[model samples]
Target: MYSLTLEQDNRATVSAAIHSDRLVVACLCAAWCGTCGSYRTSFETLASKHPDMVFLWVDIEDHADIVGDLDVDNFPTLLIQRHDTVAFFGTMLPDPAVADRMIQSIAELPDAELQRQAQSTAERRTWQSECNLRQLLNAPG
Candidate 1:
């Protein structure tokens, strides 16, 4: 397990941490955020269990530009990456049970399988958005 103490000076470290054989779980947080402060301990505990994966805690204020590609509008956001590509992105608080479930799922998956699933998920999201847009356009004014 990797515990990354992120700061403005360590932006490059964060980028390097994600490119691993094991999945990467990057928690984008802020020091002043109450939710982030409270969840930090639990997040660390969860990280210990997933020894194969890389776990990082990135403060948004310090490294906002590095994580700017991620639309982290909320604190305590999680970015899951496998093979340097994002597998999941969300702003859910720390929960060891949920963490265990996700780590277990990712650990069991092979690179090819995970890539296929990610592609499938992206395609579904694109299709859903397109369908909604088409429906809105076709609706009577």
Candidate 2:
């Protein structure tokens, strides 16, 4: 897993990853959250286990413009996407094992099925529009 910290200076790195066609696993967190602080190490460890994916640590407060429309009501929210489709977006448990399992399951799904689920419901469709990192990164500021 290639983990990258998202900051103003590194936006280009993230942009490059978005264009790479690999799975993007982003952990949306805040600097002030204790749980997030503790989970950071685990997140990195998880990242190391999946070297093919791109893991991003995005602080909601720090990068408000990029994630402004996202309603992250809890700590350690996760946004997993492949290409332009958001496969999963929501608050996750602080457990790394759970996250690892979830990632594996989602990654195993066929592209056609993932696309079907992305637009199968209102919330899922919203993820496609709002939680897609590729679109967000490309959107005009």
lDDT for each residue of candidate 2 in 91-135, tens digit (9 for 90 to 100): 999999999999998889888988998999999999988888988
Considering summed lDDT, which 10 consecutive residues are worst modelled in model 1? Answer: 129-138
Question: Which consecutive 10 residues in model 2 have the weakest lDDT in total?
Answer: 15-24
The alpha-carbon lDDT assigned to residue 51 of candidate 1 equals 80
Identify the candidate with maximal TM-score.
Answer: 2
Candidate 2 lDDT for residue 98 = 99
Candidate 1 local lDDT, 81-138, one digit each (tens): 6664455667674666786687678768887876666668765344333322113223
lDDT of 1 at 6: 70
